[model samples]
Target: MQNFLKKLRFDDVPILDKASLYELLNQRFADEEKKLSQIPNPSLLHDAPKAAKKIADAIREGKKITLVGDYDVDGISSTAIMIDFFRQIPYPLEAIIPNRFSDGYGVSPNLLKRVNADLIITVDNGITAIEAAQVCKERGIELIITDHHTPLDTLPEAYAIVNPKLSTCSYPFQEICGAQVAWLLLGLLKKELNLNIDMREFLDILCIAIIADIMPLVDINRTLVKEGLKVLMSSQRPSSLIIKDFLNKSSITSEDIAFQIAPRINSAGRLEDASISLEFLTAASTNQAYKQFEKLNSLNERRREWEAETTNEAIKLVNSDDTIIVVAKEDWHEGVVGIVAARLVEHFSKPAIVLSINNGIAKGSARSIGNVNIYELIKQNGHLLTKFGGHKMAAGLGLDEQDIDAFRIAINESASKLNSDDFKSLDEVIGILPSSEIDIELLNLLESFEPYGEANSRPLFLIKDAQILETKTFGKESSHSKVTLRQFAHEKKSIELIQFKRVLDIPSEKKLTCSYRVVKNEFNSRVSAQLIINKTYNY
Candidate 1:
C-alpha cells in the first residue's frame, strides 16, 4: 500500500464505535444554513479598506505595484490569485515569492535586497516581518501587508496591515488561511477600483490554498471550498485540467484535493523554490502547464525521498518518556523538516518538532496533535527562540544550536499541563454499512458533502465481522491487495475491498472488522463503488 500511495491518493488511521456519530451527521445535515448567503465584509478585517485603497491608488498613480508572498502552498496560491486577477485586468504586475533557501520566509530584510517597487503588497506572509517592515519604512517604499498568521506584541510598520488575527479585528471568522486574506483583499481592491471583476473568478485556486494550509473546513472556509471545488472541476484553466487529467477521474473530491493535488503543488516549495509552483498554477497554456507539471512531479518524488530518510532518522532519536517529541540533527534538509515533524506526530501520537542544524543555528518545523497548541508551546520559550510564528496546529522556529536541549526540556515541561485524553487519536466511524448497501448510490450520497477536510472530514463507515473469503496480492512488493469479504449479518453479501499498504501482521483468524472509505474503482473502463481499507481489526 505504501507504493500504491505513491502512485495514487491513499490517506488515513484509529476508530471509535459510537452511535451518536449518526446524530452528529444528522445535525450537520439539518443545519445546511452553515453556508452563508454572502461572504463577510472585507472591511470587517482590520485595515482591509486601507490596504485596498492604497493598492487602488498605486495602480492609478502608475506606481510600480509589487506583490510579495511566501513559499508555502498558501503563499504560492495567494500570489497566483493576484497574478490571475491582475492578468484579467490586463495590468502589468510584479509578483515575488521568497525563495525558502535564499530569501527565507515572507518579506524578510534579506528578501528586501531583491524587492524593488514603489508600492509593495504582501500576501500570506509579513505578519512577523518586523525587521523587513522597518527596512521598507527606511527605504521610502509604501508597504501594505495582508496576512492571516497571528500577530506578535510588536506589529510591523507597514503602511496598511490587513490581518483578521489582529487583536482589534472584528472579522466574523478568526481562523482563515493566508490566501483567504489575500482573496478578500482582492475583493476590496475590486470595490475600490470599481472594476467589474468577480471575486469568484479565483476560488479554484483559493480552494487549493485553504485545503493545503489545513484551515478548519467550516463556515466561510467550507462555503468557499464547496464553491471553489465546483469551479475547479469545470474550470478551463490549464492547471485544473492538468490535475483532472492526472487523476484520470471525472468526479473530483476533497480527498483528491488533499491527497493528490495539494501535495504536488506543495512539493516544489518543500524541496525547491516555490516559484516553480507559482509558474505551474499560473501556466498560460496546456503545454506550459504540463511543462511545469512534470517539474512538480519530479520535485515531489525528491521530497518524498528526503522526507522518508529524515523521518527514519528522527524516529530513532525519539524519547518515549517525553510528552512532546523534539528531535534535532545535523544536515537534515531544512525544507523537509516540517513534513518530518508531521510524520513523527503521526507515528508517536504526540506533538513533535524537528530541527535541522547548520552553522550553529537550528531551524525546524513543529506539528501538534489534538488540542495541543504547538505555536503557543513554542512561544512559551520565546526568549530561547530567535524567531517563531504560526497558529495552533503547526509552526516553524529558529534557535541557537546550544539551546536545543533547554528548549526541548522547557517545551516538554510546559506540555505536561495538557490533558492526556487530548493526545488520543480519534478515528470517527459511521458504523455498520452492510456489504449490500455499499454501492454507487451510497458513494454519491456521501460525496454530496464536498470538500471534506479539517473539522468536516469525509465520513468513514465500518464493515463489521467480515469473513475474508479470498485474497489476491499485487503491486510493488505485493504491498497492495484485493480481497473479497462477506458479512454474515447481511445475509452473507460479498464486496470487493482494495487494501493499500498491506498490513504485515493480521491476526490468524479469518474474520476481520474494517473501517473504510468508499472510492470509485475504475478498471477496464468500468466504474464501481469499492472500499479502500483504512484500518483492519480483529476482535
Candidate 2:
C-alpha cells in the first residue's frame, strides 16, 4: 500500500541517544520472556479435550478422517499442519481445501457432496457452517470444527467447536489465526495419544499462516513468528529450500514471507485449487516443490494481471462523496475482489466492498480503512445480505444480485453514523529523521522489532529537503523506480530508494520530502543500507 503518512511524535520520549531509545523500546516491549511464555496450554480452548479424545478414538478405530480446509493461506497452512502431524503417526488422513471456482469459501453443502468419511474436521472455516453441520449430522459423519474466526450467535452443532473468539472460549490470546488453533488442537491430540511429536517443528509453516491471516504480531504470535523464522532459516523443508533458491536469499524475514511467500501460496487458492499449494508445501521432493512453486508463481502473476484490471474497473465505480465504497461487476473474478476492495480502501480511504455477480448472487470481499469496522457496517445491512462474515478490517459476504443497489445505499447510510475520522488513512510515520542516519545501525534498530504486521508495523521516517540526484524507472513495464537522493542533512551520503507502482512525477525543482523506510538490502553476498520511498511531499 502506498502511504501518505501522518507524523507520530513522541515529544516526551527521547530517542536521540541509544540509552533513551532503548528505554523507550524496552517500555514498548515489556517483559519479552513473560509475554513469549504466555502461549497457554492447548487444553485451555473450549472443547479441546473432547475434540482430542474423539479424534484419538477415530485414529485408534482406523476410521476415515477427512479435514475440510478453506482456500486461503491460513486454511492451507492449517491443512498442511495436519498433514505434517498425521504423517508422523504414519496415519493416513485425507485433506482438501475448498476450490474457489467450484465450492466457494469454507465448508458448504456443495463441498460436502464430495466428502465421504466417518470423521470430518474443518480448519480456518466452518464457524458459520450451520447448514453444512446439519448435513453432516444427517449423514452421521462426526464433525469437529476448529477455527479462529468470529462466531455467530448460533454456533455449528458439531462434535466439537474450538474457536478463540467463542463466548465461552478460555484461551488467553484471542488474536491467534486458524492454523494456530489447528496446531493447538493437534497438540492436545498428541498428548491424548501420548505421541512424542515436537510441535515447534510446524512453526515454519505456522508462521506463514499467522502472517498470511493478518493476525496481530504481539504476545503469542510474536514468539511463534520469531521461532518460526529461526526454523525457516535452517529448515530442510522442500518449500523453504525452493523459496530460498528462488529469492536468492540465505535468510527469510517476516516481511519476505508476507510480501513474497504468502501471495504465492494465496495465488493458488485465489485463481485455482488450493490443493496445489498444499501439495507444494507438503511435497516430498525438492524437484516436486519446484514444479508446484512454478505453478504458484505463474498463477500469482496472472492474479496480479486480473487484479489490476478488476481494480481499474472498480475504480470507475467509486464515488468520492460516498462514505463507503460499494462496487461490483457482473463477472469480476471473485478471487481478486478482496484485493480490489483493499486497493479501493487504500486509494479512496473508505471502507470498500467489491462483489462479483454470477448466476443470481453477488459474492465478494470487503476491506476497511481507518477505524470503520467493515464487518459491522455490512452486518447493519444484513437484511439485504444472504450471508456475511468478517471482523473489523476485513470480511466476505454475498447477497442477491438485485440487492446490490440497496446494499450500496444502505451500507453508506450506515457508515454515515461513523465519525468523520473513521474514513481517513491509517498510515503513520514516526516523526522526521536525517537521511544521514540511514546507516546499518538505524536499520538494526528497526530490525529489533522483527516480524512486523498487524499491531506492529515497520516504522516510516520522513526525510526532509532531499535532493533527487537521479531517478529512472526500472523493472518490466517500468512498474518501479530507483531514485538516488541526497538529504540536506549531508551531501556526502546519497542513498537509493525503491518506489513501487506508477512512477512518481518528480518535482521540477528536484526537491521534496520523502516518507521512506530504511532497510538492510543484501544481494549476492553483499550487504548495504537502502530505503523504500512510500510517498513524497513537494514543497
Candidate 3:
C-alpha cells in the first residue's frame, strides 16, 4: 500500500488534520463502548401529555386508530413500532403510506378523504400541517403527531404533537429522527400503563429506522443501535419471518442493514409502492409476511437496475465544468432521484442535484459532500425556488420550468466563491497503523465502534508498503471485488490481509498505502484477519 498513499494530498483542510482524525476515531469508539443504562430521555417540549393520554384512553377502549406514514424506511419503521405496540393493547389500528410522487409530503386533504378511523396518528412527519389538521379537527378526528422535523412558526392544532425539534421542547438531544420519536412514544406508553412488555423487544425495528434515517450515531442513538443489534442477533424480536429466516442462515451486522435490509425496504419507494415494506414489517402472520417480504426483494432487484441506469447518466453530467451539477432527465424516476443525487455526489466528490423533469416543472434531490450545506445554499436562493427545505447535507427542491436556468446559474455562482480546497479531493489519511497492531486483539478492540453510520464512521487505519497478492470480482454482475494484500511491517513478519469491494480503477500491483480497518472474517470454522479498504493510494 506504499505506492497508493503517495498520491494522497489535501491542500486546504484547516480543521481535520492527522492528529484530529486519530482522536476522533479513538474517542468516538471508546465512548461508544461504554454502554449506558438508558439514554437520557428528552422531556416533552410541548405540554401534549393530555393528548397522548387521550389516545391511550382511546386505545384502551378499543377504538379504531389509523396512522399516516411516509414512504421511506424511517416512516415504515415508525409505523411498525406503533403498529406492534398497539397490537399488545388489542386496539384496532391501520396504517396508510401516501404515494411519494402524487401526495407530496405530510398529511393532506386528499388523504383525509380516504381513511375512516376514530383517531389518526402520524409518524416521521406531520409537524407542519395547519390546514390538514384543521380539516381533521372539523371532521372530529383527533390527531397525534410523532415527528422529529423542525416545526413551523405556528404549531399545528392537533390532539397532541411530539417532536424533539420544537423550540419549547426540553429534550436534551434535539437531533433524533421520527422512528426514535415513535420508539419514545412507546416507552411512554409502557411507563404509564406499567406494562411488563420487554423494552428491548422492539429494538431490531428501531435499529432499521435509526440506520435508514441517517441520524448521527451518538448520544441516545448509540445506545439504541448498540442494544438493538444485540437483540437482532439473538433473534428474539418480533420481526418478519423472512428477516428471521435470513438472520438464521447468516450473521447480521450494520453491513447487513446497508447492503441487505435497508435497500430492500427503500426499493419499494424507488420502484413501486412503499406500502409493501410496511406490510411486511407489520404482517399478522409469518405466511403473510413472507409474501410481502418476497415482493420487496423483487422490487429491490428492479431498483438496482434503475439506479445503475440513472447513476451512469449522472456520471456523464459530472463532466461539465460547473461547481454544482444539476441534471434532469424525463425518463428518470422521481422517487430514486435522492439515491441518484447521493451517487453523483460520491462520483464527482462535490455537491450534486438530480431532477426528474416532466412537463413544465422539475422536482429534484440535492446532496452535499464535505462541508457544503445544500440547505443553506438553497435558502439563500429561496426566492427562486418554488419549494425547498432540508438539512445541511441533503435537501429537496421544486423549481418552475421557467426559473430552472436562473436557479442553476445562481447556485453555480455561489459554489464558485466557496473555497474548493475543503473538498478538492477525498484523499483523507484516516489513521497510521503500526504493522504489529494488525492482530485479533486490535480487531476485537475495534468492535467498540458498532452501529456506524453518517458522522459515526468506522475507524480507518493507514498502512504502508502493502502488495496485492490476489484480486477477484464476485457477485452476479461482477459488481463486487475482493483482494488479498500482503505486507511486511515488522522484522521479517509478513501479514496477509483481505480487502473487499475496492474499485477496479485502483491499481493492483506495486507498493500501496491504504486507509483501512482491521476486522475478523469468520469462515469455515476459523477466524482470520481481514482489512476493509476505505481508500488506497500508490504513494
User: How many steric overlaps are in each model, in order?
Assistant: 3, 0, 20
Full ranking by TM-score = 2, 1, 3
Error of 1 at 426 (Å): 4.3
| Model 3: residues with Cα > 4 Å off, grouped in runs | 1-24, 29-36, 60-63, 152-155, 237-241, 247-251, 414-427, 434-436, 463-470, 474-479, 484-503, 506-513
Full-model lDDT for every candidate: 0.83, 0.85, 0.73
Write one digit per residue (lDDT tens) for candidate 2, span 196-224: 99888898899999998888778889899
* Tens digit of per-residue lDDT, candidate 1, span 450-502: 66788776777776656778888879888788888786744757888788767
| Model 1: pairs clashing at backbone N, Cα or C within 3 Å | 1-479, 1-500, 1-501
Q: Kindly list the per-residue Cα lDDT of model 3 for residues 79-113, writing each as its tens digit.
A: 88888887786566787888887787768788888
Lowest summed-lDDT stretch of 10 residues in model 3?
9-18
What is the TM-score (0 to 1) of candidate 3?
0.86
> In candidate 2, residue 286 scores what lDDT?
97
Model 3 scores a C-alpha lDDT of: 0.73
Instruction: Please identify model 1 stretches exceeding 4 Å from their true place.
Output: 1-23, 34-37, 463-466, 487-491, 536-539
